[model samples]
Target chain A: MKWADIKEKLRWCAYLASEAYNMPYRSTVARARREQDDLFMLLIFSEMMGIPNPATYYTLELQPIMLERFHDWHTRMGMEHSPLDGFRCC
Target chain B: MHRLFDRRIIFVGGKGGVGKTTIAGALALMAADGGRTTLLVSTDPAHSLGDVFDMPIGNEETPLGPNLSGLEIDPEAEAERHIATVKMSMKSLVAPKMYGAIDRQIELARHSPGTMEAALLERMADLMVDARSRFDLLIFDTAPSGHTIRLLSLPELMAAWIDGMMSYRDRSRRLGEVLKVFSRDQSKEDGFGMIGGSQDEPDDSRDGRIKEILMTRRRKFHRARELLTDASTTAFLLVLNAERLPILESKKTLDLLSKFNVPVAGMIVNRLLPPDAGGDFLRERRLQEDEYREEIDQTFAGLRRIYLHLLPHDVHGVETLREIGEAMAEQLGGAFGAAKAP
Candidate 1:
């Protein structure tokens, strides 16, 4: 799948995880994306798990570069797509 | 004498990798040599007191100088001790069959917010209370600024929570007494002991005594806070390098301490590259050092700035610590008032 599609899916997963965990939706989505390394893998994993917050172990292992890429993807997606796009997954 | 070194608690904290422990060691040496019974304690989870002193520093106090003692609190050991105390307390109160479940809960609570650092602080306060006469000064080689703030503030937060719990216990006792009187049974007296833990029950008295001891600990916390805030009794020294990160972090720390009403006594600029003797690299380092020295002076006005030359070897063992003590004294214009040639 394309990186953009993967990031979109990851965003959706983050939204779902935040809702499930009763965390602030936007904050959890930010935290989830901030924690991912490869935008493509983050998207793929989010799509597969259908939940966002990444597991605790994954969060702990996250690197700065991964977080940077995830942030770039998130920013690009935010500009092009509706902010409400991920809400349906929740 | 300005009584500069008579401080009860000397906190050495700044960004990591800035020689905080080394400076703390030197200060402890000076305090000890000056005849104050000083205890140098490290609250940092990443223990370096052993490495700094070149001696084993366990939970127990170890004498370093004529009147100086050192302690490096092992967080894991402290956490285990905390868990054991909690488990024992729970076992004394609850049913025997439920002790196992309560122990698990206590273990979980051990990792709860602020428990590890708080336990360390409590242990430190307990040490001070027990050794009040033995030691006149407690020098804390605190962790980096953030962790140190949390550790220092733990006492105030814990004290407030304990006070609230004590009030709740009082209310519960009153309710229990009322319910027992209405029931008109001898078992009602047992109910009185349930909440208040009456004189009749030895086990209850043990728990009650623990609570009383904890309440009594409020004075120690108050004393510690006073020692921290009063300029006469405490001196919080910030140890920093000329590097950008440490300098910026020190600035923020100074601001935070001011916000908390903790008086910052001075700043120690450690590991400064000496002015050029020969090499181009040394000359360039000296230039950077001059620039940062200017910045530090400008930023932290009216505060005494002490600069120590970079040493060839790592600061370890009492010999090196003594050398550092000499350097520190000269920089601060204390006992050993003049800098000696290397």
Candidate 2:
């Protein structure tokens, strides 16, 4: 009825429409992102899984920044423990 | 001798205990004696340069003689230094609390396979680039055949690995940027901006810290690869004894180096018994050595050959090394002269 109230209601409507439009795409993107992150972690920490890593010395510096992501990645990959968990090598 | 003198870098490789260090030292001594400033770098973990020069030459370049300097890169020390450098850079990238865990991981990685070799190679790359302007020549007295081959091949492997990392980083960063815009999260965008505030360029946004690291390493490896593969700048000399196994191993090594496109400068046959030795035992060994010598000349016919006689005593200190150097200089005369022709 009032101009101010109309503007607020229209804003809420737009917000809801945007959310509805983005949900499916966001989920798909999120799934893809998780997969990519998993792949990245594998590439970096493959040596921890007994793979012969030629660049392990170069990758050691990255371990600190990716620790949490590495933990989550390992857990999601169905491992009961992190590859470097007990020693916290990840 | 002329080609080797003209080249900036020389890698001496051979079977274990083949007196590679001795021959490499002699070459370096000869180069230095010719008024060229030569840096002899021993990459062997079991360093004998100190013994060869009979001096306490550690990691630092110690003056072995006029225009000659010696450096023995202890693998363990180099590995520790490399780890410390990585950790120092990582301090800026990670939180304080994460240091302990990351340090532990790095320590484990230090002991991991290939870490020593990688560190040694990194040090070598550093020397090659940094010492290019400082010295007339750099002679690397490398580890045994297999180890040296692997070390030489590392630049290519490192290049491939860095390329993969860079592509992955690029993809991840692009996706992250796209997600940030699509989500329209102003707070998250501001957070990223704050995190990367140390860098202000728009180009900085495209490359994360890891990507920058990968790029730097790629560049280093690229330069090293270029230097290593260049026939004019680099030469790999095979050192062998007048023995069957050394001959066979040298042949195998030459094949491998050729496969890697590494330039084989020549072969040095060390510990040749004198032809006129009078003792029965010495004569018997000399007879056996003659057979292997013939095989070596036949097998490596195309390669320039240098022969050093088996000394009556152990070759230690500068005097004997000088003697060996004089012999090598004579043998290398035509080769070095020919190299200067073009």
Candidate 3:
């Protein structure tokens, strides 16, 4: 057998062996990702929280794409219900 | 002299009721008569360009003469229009399911305090950036003193804000990339057979879109600031009366303008009492006027000053503006007439 072929088979076996076990860091990575998303949304949408942003008009178009995550963000920040839950058609 | 008319952009500002609109209109007329295509724009929410011209000018550009065009931008209307345009652009980008909620948020933003000023400044910056190629001169009849200063300074403030946002976005993006690598490695260890497809990173379309929008605004503000602070191209004319209050206000405003690197073109002492009035009451008023004029000359020393007589009637219509323009032309003389650019 060629050296390259032997190396490739060994790597595949190692990957298959590692795949047999569960990982503990999965939940932590997910939480970090969510927090980053929340921070980004907050920077753009703080005008909605009664903070005056001069560039709010420019960011209005960003609302549609951010709408789905916005709900989860508000809830995670301790709101039992969405502020615009009544207007929610999604 | 002709130097004022030679500038690309001129901003006329003063205390309310000091005839800024009238002076701005006359300046525009003079520039146009000099064979330059001039645009006179009013940035006041409470517009009076129509009153000054004695013609019904709206929020859009209205031609007043062969070479002069006038635009009266209302802050409220401009804010609404900005919102509408943003919403329309979002129509194709935003999913239908989330439309109603986003629309409500945008409507609420319309009533916010800074939103109107932002919209107005954005429109002004747009004009400065986009209209540079189309007109020889742009004369702005600005809102009452303080508001106009704020409007003039917005480009710098917004540029700083954009810088902050841009850096924050870059940091967050880098963090996201790092976290993605970590997650991919963790999934690999768990033998999930390449979770998230291994090569497929999270969708960063939002970051790209936001960065594009911010970058465009930053460029506009950068150009606007450069144009505004370039003394060779921009001039700020302070219109004031010879009375104590306007003179004091003008002094403070001049200090503010120079401090901000805005070129102080000159001061126009509008509404001077005529010297030939033949009554004791008029004589007494003239004596006091002489004292104030002397003080004005002393206070604003070394600056080009123009003194104009108070007209018998309220200045209205194109004919009166032309007459005033001619009078101003005589006072300016032919000295310092060469346009200097460095």
* Per-model chain A TM: 0.25, 0.75, 0.61
Displacement of the residue B120 alpha carbon in candidate 1, Å: 0.9
Off by over 4 Å in 2: A78-83, A86-90, B88-103, B185-207, B335-342
Better of 1 and 2 by lDDT: 2
Q: Mark the 10 consecutive residues where model 3 chain B has the least summed lDDT.
A: B333-342
* Collision pairs in model 2: B1-B336, B2-B336, B3-B336
Tell me the spans in candidate 3 whose CA falls farther than 4 Å from its real position: A1-37, A84-90, B89-98, B183-202, B334-342
DockQ comparisons of all candidates to the true complex: 0.01, 0.36, 0.34
TM-score of candidate 2 against the unseen true structure: 0.87
Q: Which candidate is the best by lDDT?
A: 2
lDDT, candidate 1, A1-90, per-residue tens:
999999988976765564454323323433342333223334322422234331211111121112223334445555342222322111
- Local accuracy of candidate 2 as per-residue lDDT tens digits, B23-105: 88888988888899999999999899999888899989898888999999977888898789877865666678777766776
Candidate 1's docking class is incorrect
Candidates in order: C-alpha RMSD to true structure = 19.4, 4.7, 4.7
What TM-score against the true fold does each predicted structure earn?
0.67, 0.87, 0.86
lDDT of 3 by residue, B206-265 (tens): 668778888988999899999999999999999998899998988888888877789989
Candidate 1 on B154-241: residue-level lDDT in tens? Answer: 5566556446545544553444344334333333323422222232244244336534654665566776666557787777889998
